[model samples]
Target: MTSPTPQAPVRRPTAADGFVVVDKPQGWTSHDVVGRLRRLAGTRKVGHAGTLDPMATGVLVLGIGKATRLLTYVVGADKDYDATVRLGVATTTDDAEGQVLSVAGPGAVEGVDRPALDAAVADLTGDIQQVPTSVSAIKVDGKRAYALARAGESVELRARPVTVSRFEVLAVRQVTATVADGGPDVPVVDIDVRVTVSSGTYVRALARDLGAALGTGGHLTALRRTRVGGYDLAGARTLDELEKQADADGTLATLPMAEAARATFPVRELDEDEVRALGYGQWVAPSGRPEVVAAISPSGELVALLEDTRRRGDDLARPVLVLAAH
Candidate 1:
């Protein structure tokens, strides 16, 4: 009897080069989603625009394949969230995942009514200095702040400027809540808010600040990011949905790189010569817009991200990132 020949391993088709807005589930870190996407896309070239806390759930913009190059620009876009700020209990991590630090007495929360809450929200709105939660990704002397905090080291982060464009209180409720591991109840006020903030703003910090302004310590109990720049929950797909698509057709649906760039940036339609110039690492005429512009080829392909630069007394646009080769 002749020995049977072994068959080669089957390879799945790679996913298209584009962006995917994932409806990130709670308790999954942004990196966790990327790890899963790498398998689904059959490519390791996956990146995310911003990091979402493991406890947070909502719109997480992911870039796959060539679209990963565009996430640098996407990270600067504003974000929106619906969050619940619990006033009366302070936590070590400034969220429900942390240990209870302090619980406010009943009298403290009762003083924070609608008008007072509104005033506090207004104070936090617009441009303000905010101290981020100690347990954050911020680096302290080349070490992550959260790592230091977890190691029982004191982490005092400096306040930074952040813009809270919209901070509307949707509802307020007074209820008894458990503040400790054991089931002892305390009176607390929970304020639901819809917040639109600049790229670097931290909603958990906002929750903490609101409580401090109201004379009650506070922490974030719930956080759901509804939007990240042009990407929103309406267009997001769950991990299971993506897996189903991949399993059915060996690929996941994604917004093409050109479409993603056009939607997120100012466009500069390039002529043949300009397209050739960018592809060859040369400069072209300035688009006159100060912001980064999406340089598009005549065939509607995204060529590069162009920025105006003055060289030899003439203003010209240079390729910050060349996406498509001519």
Candidate 2:
């Protein structure tokens, strides 16, 4: 008789509320990270603010316990990426992982110099209409676009407005490349770039458009996200690091929900009287800052997320989400 495999010990749930900034490894899906974290954090409430593609690697923000409620606002924040776009080849998925669609003729990609590349980059900067890559996670009629595309369905997505606040070329390299469509090796120009764009902007789509505009088909070869809203690589920890930390003492360095709120939104410290009224769901006077503001107690606890709105004719800062009990 064979001995059964040793089962791992399951840690008890702690239900601690906070966020974990993970330096997501390549090949691990966003859900894959969350599933692993569910085990490490000793809770099933682990959730991420944004989904990073398996090919992309960098900072991925995760929320624990009640922190999941704050992820919606985080999803709307701007993003930054460091990507390499190879001008000379196009791919079915607009990235290196996809099969090549076409290859540029010899000397075609080389003809695109610094000035030409800059002009193309300029054209992509600022607010522009962008069609998300077909393999993206966008949903069509409730089915994920990627899911449909993977199943051999033709996907035609529409263009939408997105702001590319900054698009700067960091370096350029000239070399020969192989085509994924089984074509002969061709000369290619690889342009390394960094972009800061509004939420929902597709960097892969930008690579496709950049190549199309230059008349020398292109696709993303590498992508690494450096920043997401207020959270950046500087604050991130690797999954291995987190796992070791968890094993050492069943603990993690989580950003408390109040600190996370303050990091993402401006604060409005409330007095004792306002705190009492807010506990009952009553509206308080406006705190000057527009949009969603974090309402904190003088003692530094985040009480709720508040928004100023007009009720009848009077303006009041109503509680959008109450975080604390009386």
Q: For each candidate in turn, give its C-alpha RMSD to the true structure in angstroms.
A: 2.4, 1.9
The candidate that achieves the highest lDDT relative to the unseen native structure: 1
Question: For residues 16-63, what per-residue lDDT tens digits would candidate 2 score against the true structure?
Answer: 788989999999999999998888777889899889989999989999
Model 1, residue 19: C-alpha shift (Å): 0.8
True-structure lDDT of candidate 2? 0.90
Provide the TM-score for each candidate, comma-separated. 0.95, 0.95
Q: Please list the residue runs of candidate 1 whose C-alpha ends up more than 4 Å from where it truly belongs after superposition.
A: 1-11
- How many angstroms is residue 102 displaced in model 1 relative to the true structure, after the best TM-score fit? 0.5
Give each model's whole-structure lDDT: 0.91, 0.90
State how far residue 8 of model 1 sits from its true place (Å).
10
Give per-candidate clash totals: 0, 0
lDDT of 1 by residue, 222-277 (tens): 99999988889999999999999888876788898888997799898989999898
